[model samples]
Target: MKHAPDFLSQEHDPRDPNPWLAMYLDRSTPIDDEVKRAWLADSSSRSRQVILPFVRPFARTLIVLFQVLKFVTPRKLAFSRTLHRLLAWGMQNFIRPEANWLILRHFHVGSQVLAFIGANSPAPVETSPLTPQRIGDVRDDLFLVHDLNLYNFVIRLNRALHAAGRELEHVAEPDFSMIAQPGLRLEDMPDGRFNFLDLQSSIELFTPIYQLLLTDDDFWRATNSLQLDETIGLYAATILDARSHLVLLNNRHPLVPMSTLRAGFRLTLHGLSTEMLHKVLFDRRAAQEAAQAALFAAGG
Candidate 1:
């Protein structure tokens, strides 16, 4: 295969900026949009660097659990060891109340997780015995990757807020409330009644206009005072406190990775550097990139 010996220099074509080269090699780029995209996407490696250091102990426990679950001869003995290991893992991870506190303090955000609440945190409803086993259609289970990022931001915020001692009733409101300025909608839920709203699927559902909303100078000023971590925690705490008010379209879309939630309120804040989040919280680099690509493709 004749791969370009210096693929990094291929952007001489002028039309395509060849952002992926900058992305992988961490080289500098003249184009601002390309630079930001490369940075945000590159965080997978960064996340590994930060998170892998903390995961070895948990990993070892899992290895022990798997070994015990696999080869022990007596059923009762196996069950007992397995249960002990599993419970220990759970307590270390998410079962401890203090873990919940750290999650709120460090990693929550506004638009992602809070949208799932109903009038109250909806209790698990029993499916009907008459319901067909295959009642729901199974598909690839992929959603627009963009929505996942935003959704995660909100879910973490809610978890953090709950850890901070707020009730879901006291805080959460829809993104539309912040973006569109609407009054609260109250309703009932499995646990209790409180304020709520049924939200549509995907933050991108509002993408065409979300930029305009985000651009409001007043909004930026309002949110600017809070540090990124503090903001995320408050966002999550508010949502959990107002869990009854959230109406989430997709249930499978998780707020936090179950592993993180169970690991005791711990959060791995992913995607882009904190400096970048601050700079671009008021900007729309991704939307701008897509628009530029489309414009170039159309010969505009």
Candidate 2:
């Protein structure tokens, strides 16, 4: 049976609000005085990796530059679909491991950059009923992009499940309704290409982190015959989590309908993967061209 997240039930008073994100914390691991001392024992020894780094600002610059270029050349987005289909080809041909690794790494790094550096915090919630000053408060444009991102995510997630001999039986809806709906799907794109400069910079991936994010174990579980309800619940929980975060940030019940967030998450994931695949394919093509040129020169 589907149940609401335990976080919601943990609130002692129904009317009382939870202001912080307690979800990312490890509630099961409590630190006693001894444990606390042990944990802080190495605090004096510092490492350069702990800091987020000033280089993030530079990465932000490249991300924006490429984003603008991708938007301007619609063909890049189109070709991304063609290249992404190769993952299916690899699966059928028994090279699924490497293909999956490439996909996960590309996706993980791009998403990490976008999540940590590209995206801004949630927009200020417009609490007061519609007024002239608050007219701009309802950010339809912001939600449009969010919806696009979500829509892409769902398509890729379904594709991932499909490769594992499973599929998402249902798509979850969010609390907010979006005014603009995307009409196109991955299948709608024709094979094509645009400028490759948008992909010149490699997305920096930390292998350890992406390894942790890989869904190979989950895929193996699916091969044992996962049921429809499992997929439904997975997506349903995601929608609830997104809504909960929004509710916390806004500090008020959202006026938006649930349908919006659900659709957006699905769309964005698909789009994000497509963009990542395009970069990988572009780099591969460049390497092949250079290799061919060198071979021809040696022969001459």
Candidate 3:
């Protein structure tokens, strides 16, 4: 016989706001007090918020740089030139008066390593695709380059916020309305390991954080299995207990719609693996030419 759904499934006060989050919290442990204490003293909190939203522009620039370096001869990108173009376009078209404040107010969380850094993930340098030789491309553009502008921006912004006396306390609440769900399933088989970047970045394991952000419409979108959703919810509960500011929604773009959010959730949860993430992030392209040359000489 089916027992009544767990207490969480019961309708509760909407004003309570984050019950899904709260239920998940109830099932977890508190983050280390030392971690919160360190964040409180550090001015990086405000800077992280200020610099995070700008990450997508940087990500787009980096993605292009990634593509360019892959195909460019000598494996040295003319990133400095492209970077100038990116910055001019970004400052004029992307960053604006209204967006300036909005960008500074909320912490950013996207589907890339930049997003992870913005959230102050425990490990940044290790997860970053940046390296010494490849770092030049990042330096080429302030707006379009794969450089450390975002990182520097965070530092400067933190100084400004510290002067203004703002600190980001980790938040917790009652609703599950805006959380992300898991995307991977046991049955997907050999194809499961395909998306390399997601795997290396721990995206597959972090599906629960994405699941909590899904809506009722999204909840019903599953035609094949609901197991991933449940797994995602449970997994999200675990991660949230570790980082409260890791808010649950894909970056909502103007042209995108409700369904895009679902797809983003699927991508975050279902299509990731640890090995793939490491390969995409740490796999250096600058050495590709030398490595391939050596291989060709030895074999063919």
Model 1, 1-300: lDDT tens per residue?
111223443555567555445465553322224323323332233333354445545543543444344344432231223333432333233221222121121122222222322222322111111111110100111112123434344455456556765544432222222111112111111111211111111111112122222222321222221223433333333534422222211111232222211221111222222222322322333444567799899996
Per-candidate TM equals: 0.20, 0.21, 0.20
Evaluate model 3: give its lDDT. 0.29
Measured with C-alpha atoms, the lDDT of residue 157 in candidate 3 is: 40
- Give, for candidate 1, the lowest lDDT window spanning 10 residues: 195-204
Please give the TM-score that candidate 3 achieves against the real structure: 0.20
Model 1, 2: alpha-carbon shift in Å? 37
Candidate 3, after superposition: displacement of residue 69 in Å?
Answer: 9.4
Question: Cα RMSD to native, each candidate?
Answer: 22.5, 25.3, 24.3
Cα lDDT of model 3 by residue, 1-300, tens digit: 012213334466667654333534351332222222222222123333354345434443443443444454433323344434443333233332222211111111112323322343222112232221221222343222122333343454456457767543322431222212122222221212221121212221222222222222222232112223232222233323432322332223212333322332344232222212212222222244457789899997
Best by lDDT: 3
Residue 112 error for model 1, in Å? 5.7
lDDT of 1 at 87: 29
Tell me the whole-model lDDT of each prediction, alpha carbons only.
Answer: 0.28, 0.28, 0.29
lDDT, residue 88, model 1 = 31
Q: Which ten residues in a row have the lowest lDDT in candidate 3?
A: 101-110
